[model samples]
Target: MIAIRLRSSCGAALVGVLALATSGCGLSAELDRETNPERKPTPSETRAVLPPVSATPSPSVSVQPVSGCPSSGLRFEVGRVDGAMGLRAMTLSMTNCGEQPYELNGYPSVSVLDEAGAPIPGVRTAEGTDEVPVAPPGSAPEPFTLKPGETARAGLLWRMAAEDGTYLRVAPDKKRDFVNVRPEEPLDIGPENILGTTPWAPAS
Candidate 1:
């Protein structure tokens, strides 16, 4: 009876040991699953982020007529402007829109004006093409007559200055009333403040 009891106790202890070992292995596996998960496959394509587009419009030159003909019956317009090496050349034209012939003997009086039509101060006006050599040299003023529907042209030259003008106050001569003419582009005058003009000549 003593040998049989001893064997039975040993059998029970062996079974308890086996249960503990199995439980320990299950707990270890659960812990590993919690700590480290399975990895997923990587995708071949990725999305990209981009910046927002702007809504403001860029500035452009105006093509509409800015002024009407003065009582002098001559219409003045600012023509093409050419720039090179900091020098600017502009063409000024006057059309005889009246019924009779118009007399133009000399260089037209020109002054840079602000948006308010007021002359910009400190700008010097030269009557010949000597100071600014961008345009063709002008001949001395001689009395000339423009028939109706004819046009006369003058060359204006200047270095880039510090001031910008919106309008040009032009007169056929110093004695006539000034007419405002708008250029396609604003005049960008620098610190030089000097404007040179050639004498009125027949447009070829």
Candidate 2:
């Protein structure tokens, strides 16, 4: 009876030990699965997007008219300005280096134009009502006359409404031929040719 009881006790102890070992293996596997889970991308994966670049436009150049009287004859040159008001108020001048007297008629005409070459506002002369006539070299000088070896200067104050390109035309009177005047300076009446060849001053 004693031998039978001891064998029974040993059998119970072996069953308990196997049960404990099986439970410990199951807990270790569960812990490994909980600690290392499968990975997946989140919804905020937008770091690869890029922004676009923009380009700038080139600037346009403004042109004015100019005419000069050299000793031999008339020489013509064109001037180009970049600012806004250079087209509005201006001073037109001419140098007379000939032995005879020279006469200039009609005020310089101002015209404001759009990109299509159509006149933006209207074309007009910017001068006062005073008549400027020609006389002898030493006599009183005015806008229309330049004594021999004398320099004649005139002022033009123009009011304009322009968006882009505006220009001035310094033309001689249709009746008066600049070639007939002494030292025969070239006559310029085109757009974009009026500023430098002829010395100028700002309207005061």
Whole-model lDDT per candidate:
0.70, 0.36
Q: Supply candidate 2's per-residue lDDT for 36.
A: 62
Clashing pairs in 1: 160-190, 161-189, 161-190, 162-189, 162-190, 162-191
Candidate 2: residue 105 Cα off by (Å):
7.0
TM-score of each: 0.63, 0.32
For residues 3-95, write the lDDT of model 2, one tens digit per residue: 233234445656787899899999987876776665443367558756542111113423322234444432222222211222222334545
> What TM-score number comes out for model 2?
0.32
Q: Give model 1's TM-score versus the native structure.
A: 0.63
- For model 2, the stretches where C-alpha displacement exceeds 4 angstroms are 1-88, 104-121, 126-145, 163-166, 177-204
lDDT of 1: 0.70
Candidate 1 Cα deviation (angstroms), residue 160:
0.9
How many clashing pairs per prediction, in order?
6, 10
